[model samples]
Every structure is written in C-alpha cells, then in structure tokens.
Target: EGYGLTEASPVTHCNPIYGRRKPCIGIPLPDTEARIVDLETGEKELPVGEIGELAVRGPQVMSGYWNMPEETEMVLKPDGWLLTGDIAKMDEDGYFYIVDRKKEMILSGGYNIYPREIEEVLYAHPKVKEVAAVGVPDEYKGEVPKVFIVLKEGETATEEEIIAYCRENLAKYKVPKYVEFRKELPKTMVGKILRRVLAEEERKKMAEAG
Candidate 1:
C-alpha cells in the first residue's frame, strides 16, 4: 500500500486511492524525490526498469539519528538522499516495485539472485503456506539459495517435489539447492519474515559442522 522507513517520517510513497497498481508502491509524494541508484556505490542513478537501491530526498526525511552520526552518515548521503537499502525498480509509468533487500541478495556462481523471486514461486504451490529463501554458504558458488517452507495445514510435500517444481519455473542458478520444512518461520511482530535470522542460523550450522 505504501513504502517508507522510520527515517522518512515513516511514509514516502503510497498508492493512489484509485487506479493504483497491485504490488506497486506508487509514485513519490509531492516534494519527495526518489530514484534508483547503483547498488554497489549508491551514486550512479540507474535508468528506468533497472533494479537498484532506492534513494529518497524530501522534507519528511530525517536529518540524522540521535547521537549516532556514524550510523546516520552511512545511510544519509552528503546531498541529503537517504539510501533505503531496498532493491527496487521503477516502471515507465513511474510506479516503483520492490524486488528485495540489497543485503539479502544471493550471489551464486556469479549470478545475482533475489530471494523474493524464489519465494514467490514457492508461495504459488498449493501445499506451501509460507516460504523464505535464504543464501547459505556454498564452497563452489560462494553462496547458494536454500528455501525454508511452511506447508499448509493438513498438507504434505517433499523436498524433491518442491525442487522439481522450482526447476520447472526458475533458472538453474536460481533454483534452490536445499530445502527445510518448518512449522513456522521466524517473524517480526508485524509479520515480516526474518530472513537474516534464518541466514545466521545456517552460518552457525556450518561453523558447528566444520
């Protein structure tokens, strides 16, 4: 419905009351400027349809975090733009769509993979109630996607079946190499899945096994 962060007074973009596109965050509000920038440096402004970090500058944007100049400086650019740390793209119509978080992106075999893309495919499976795709340590590829799925009540599915389904819908590199079925996923009070927590758990498991 809307897109923003606490640093931006919590609201920056919202869908129009009418003619709003599904899953799009809509155009920037009055006096607010938003752009897609290079994910690496967050400096080069990307062209439309290019996936990059979303940055915003407006009156509602926060000046700085309380007594945390270093933390503030990391996000707030010298020119006043605040990097939202979200991987996003803008359509020709100016509607913005979030692909995923920059930090959550998986780099496997030199290919960039967004977890949301994988999660969306799994969510379409009738037996899957919820799913999260996270990058786990991989010796050959540096990192590979591993999916954690929560099956619908009274439904049963196997890892092989899920993998086969993904293989049909996704590229070879984007297909998850491992799967873990869970009763429920770690979530925030607002119901956002905690991919970072899952990723940390995988890292710990690798360390323990080694």
Candidate 2:
C-alpha cells in the first residue's frame, strides 16, 4: 500500500517488501516525515493511534499549485508540511490507516461524523454488499448522515434492521438518519465509491421536493 497526492508528486508512503499490514497504506518513504495533526487546528500532532489529518514533508512534495497562492496556503504550511486532506491514524509499528477525508466529515447536531466509520459498520452486515454514506442537509441539524446500500446476492434486509445494526455498533449521533437501497453504489473507474455523487443527488432530491 502507498499514500500520495498530486501535490506530492506521487508516492509518499508504502509498505516495505518484507513487512506489510492489511488495510494499511504503509510507512513513510525515504526522506519523508509524516505526522498526524489535529483536524481543527492543524497545528498540534496527535499521539500514536489517534486519528487526525496526515501531514507530510519531503523533497518529493510540490512547492505549491501553479499560481494558486490562496489555495496553496490552505494546504502547504510555511513549515514545509503538506496537509493531506485525508484523516488517518498511525499505529506504533508505523503503519498508517486512513479513516476518512477531512472535507467529507459531516457536522450534524453539533456532532462530527465520519462517513467511513458508519460505512465500516454497515459493511459488516451479512446482507450488505456495498455501501456509501454521505451528509444530507437537514432543516433541524444543518446536516444529517444518510447511507445508500446494495445488498449481497440473494440477501435481504429492512431499513429498520440495517439502522438497528448500526445502532448496536455506533454512537447515537453517528447513526444515519436515512437508509436507501440502491441497485449498486456509484463508483469510480478504479472501483472507489463516490460518496460526493450520492450527496449531490440527495441535495437535488431535497430541492425538488421543496
């Protein structure tokens, strides 16, 4: 596994040929230094196993986007660390696990909910084949998390049953307000789920209803 962004000029982290961990993006590459910084402040580094933004400093890292100073300042810190929008946690063994995306975090009822966290819970259901969770605008809470799911072949489940499964494994505030069944979740060419597409669809549906 490797971790990198366009601004980073490509690969930054990858598991060594000799050692690898499942679900880990791997250790920082040579000449690269990585840290998990607080999501809100983006200043203080968090301890091991704590989830936060993954920041990296290396020669391979880009100086800034061409001619986009304001946007550059948002991600490129003066101290030389590039703030990757990915939220992640590093274990003691130095392996990194991506939790979610900072911009994708849902703020609902004064709670910060990571869609990946809910997706993780939902994916464990025997009937679930695929799922994508997104934040939808809610009149009372500003935004509430909702999920779209695709069931496994020959499996079936009710909305209440799925919600109850999540409730058992997740905090109350983290529970999705709406559950939708889809023939299939949207995906990118590489087979990555496109949660933003679902979120935008929900917004349009709400607008049409209004």
Candidate 3:
C-alpha cells in the first residue's frame, strides 16, 4: 500500500508484505481488483500462478498522461487500459506480489536479473548487514550481477565467503558474479537504497581503474 499515483488512481491493489505495519497493504480493502499481463506481447493475461507486469483496468484507472501524447499513447492503449510499469504476480488466493520496478530488470546473457531475489538471499545470511545487487558489463554475458555488501558492526566476512554463501543459496546464474564490501551504504533521507547511483559509481571506478 504505497502512494497512489496518476496511473493507478485511488490505489486499489496491494499485498501484505510486512506485519503490523500501518493496517494492511497486501489484502485489498474490498471493491477493488487487479490483473497481471505479459509486457512484451500484452496478449497473455497470465494466470495467478505466473509472474508478469501488473495491469489494472477499473473505475480507478487514470484517464491519460499529463500532456505528452506519445508517452500517453504508449502507456494508455486504445482499449482503455493503463500499463503500470511494475512487475508483479498474483497468488492463487488472489493477492498480488510486486517483484521489481520495470526498468530495474537486468539483462545478463539472456537472463533477467532481479535484484530483490538476490538481495533477499544475501539478507538471510547472518553476517550480511545490507546488500544491493546490480548488473555490470560482461564480455560474454553482456551484463552480470554484482553485489555491494555492508557487514554488521563488529562482524567481518571475506568476499569469497559471501560469494560461496550465495552460491549455496541461489542458482549459479542468480548468484552474484562480483562482490564488493564497504563499511557503510549510501542512503537517502527516506532510506531506500539508491541502486542506480551505486551502479554508476562502480562503472566510473572501473573506467578510472582501466
């Protein structure tokens, strides 16, 4: 249950991710519904068991974008539906789970790397304090997953050990191809991880090192 933007007016869909945190965002408050669709084709209205971009077309849907006609046309189709650029999947029980932001999908050797999947595994490790997974350039794969980690105070873990741990938990393709440790992580006033900024900084460092 985040802020309701123009695309999804009045905020109709949500999932209960956290417990005891400001009512319930997960379960729909009633009189609201949602759906999932394949972004590439937009033909398959995937079943609840599949993962796809979340699209909602109801009374709460937005009319159109502010001004940009092309941008508005790209999102709002002739069928009167707004394609929210959020990736999500619905459960058999009818609740929807937001996977990642649309633009955040990292393409690595034909694989889609979602940072949340990798970050979830990293967070489960006892020594890992905070982690952000990003895609870095790779000659063969086009791009590869890289993990930026911050350890808990008074704890220390080598990059190899961390990588090994991830290997044990994730698929070989899902495991981070690169690992970097830092004392503290950069954060904004609201404390959401700024991944794009970190990825850019890492690319800059690589350029300087070269």
Candidate 4:
C-alpha cells in the first residue's frame, strides 16, 4: 500500500508494480523526496533502518493550511518539508515502512514502544480476535502498555496466559503490563480501532483511582 496525506495532495509513495515489498509503503514517487528525521527536533535526518518521523517535500505538497498560520507552521517547514506525524523507516532498497503514528507511541521506561508491534504479537495468539495496545499512566515508568482484547468466539484466555504469550514474543520492556478482556473494542465508523479513545479512558481511570 502507498502512503500520503491531505497536506501532501494525498499521494506520495507507493509500491512499484514490480519489486514491491509486502507490508511496505514503497519508494517515493518521481520528484517526491522523503526522509526519516529525528523525532525530538525533526532536524537531523536518521540513518536507514532507524525509526523516526517521516518528512516529505515534493511538487504535490501544500504551501500552507488555509488561514491557519500557527497550525501550518507546526507541520510545514520553511525548507518545504512537510512533517507527516508518522513514525517510519526506510530500508537499504529504499522501500519505506510505516511503523505507527507518532502520537500513539508509548514511552515506557525509556523505551519507545509502538502499539502496532504489540498488537501484531497479540493477534497471533489463537484466542485473540482483536486487540488494542495503549499506554497507560505509570508512576514509576511514566507510562506502560495495557492491552484490551476481544477473544475469538468460544475461546477462553486468562490475563496470565496473554502476558506469558507476550513475554515469550516481545522484549521485557515492550511486553504489555496489563491485559483486559472485552466484549468488543471501540472503533470508528469506518471500523478502525480507536486507540486514542482507549488511552484517554485509561488516563481518566487512573486519575479517578488516585
């Protein structure tokens, strides 16, 4: 699949008709330049295979948002690069892979954890029908991963079983610290899982508990 945004005239990168890598967004289109930059400052370009925010510049990119200078300036650099707010990396072959959205990243104990990485592992579990991994507030770690899951029909699973599965598949820092079984996960009208909503709920719950 390709990657683009409304700010970029909606099309930037795509897998070539041939030599396309599965699950990769492919290379930049002709005249479109894309780079992975340091997430903290968005200045230093990151090396290949390193995950960072994606920035792009091309003929198709927008000049500015209509009458929204502050918002426009936040994303559009004077040098013509548009910050995509997407975590991504490029391979040696020049194929671009989207890791996840920057806002949804979980900062747990100094490790950068992407919910998609955790969800992918949980999805592989035989009993898991759907899952959403989100960062919840943690006093000691600043934040930690907590997963909400919907089990497959007639399937049974325990929090310990799920945690053990993650412990086996993921690094210690990346494994979710909490598991909550649910009848269904919240979703957008288009059926995309609402991870932000889950995260907000978690924060609210922690606030109430304290």
Best by TM-score: 4
lDDT of 1 by residue, 1-210 (tens): 899898998789988887756678888988999999998899999999999999999999999999999999889999999999899999988889999999999999998999999999999899999999999999999999999999999999999999999999999999999999999999999999999999999999999999
Error of 3 at 164 (Å): 0.4
lDDT of each: 0.94, 0.91, 0.77, 0.94
Candidate 2: tens digits of C-alpha lDDT, residues 30-141: 8999999998889999999998999999999899989999999999999999999999999998888888999889999998899999998988888999999999999999
User: Higher-TM-score candidate among 1 and 4?
Assistant: 4
Full-model lDDT, candidate 2: 0.91
Query: Higher TM-score: candidate 3 or 4?
Result: 4
Worst 10 residues of 3 by lDDT: 20-29
Each model's Cα RMSD: 1.4, 1.5, 3.5, 1.2
- What count of clashes does model 4 give? 0
Q: Give the TM-score of candidate 4.
A: 0.96
Which 10-residue window in model 4 sums to the lowest lDDT?
A: 16-25
Looking at model 2, the pairs that clash are none
Residue pairs in collision within model 3: 15-26, 16-26
Question: Across residues 69-165, which tens digit of lDDT does each residue of candidate 4 receive?
Answer: 9999999999999999999999988889999999999998888999999999999999999999999989899899999999999999999999999
State TM-scores per candidate: 0.94, 0.93, 0.85, 0.96
Q: How many pairs of residues collide in each model?
A: 0, 0, 2, 0
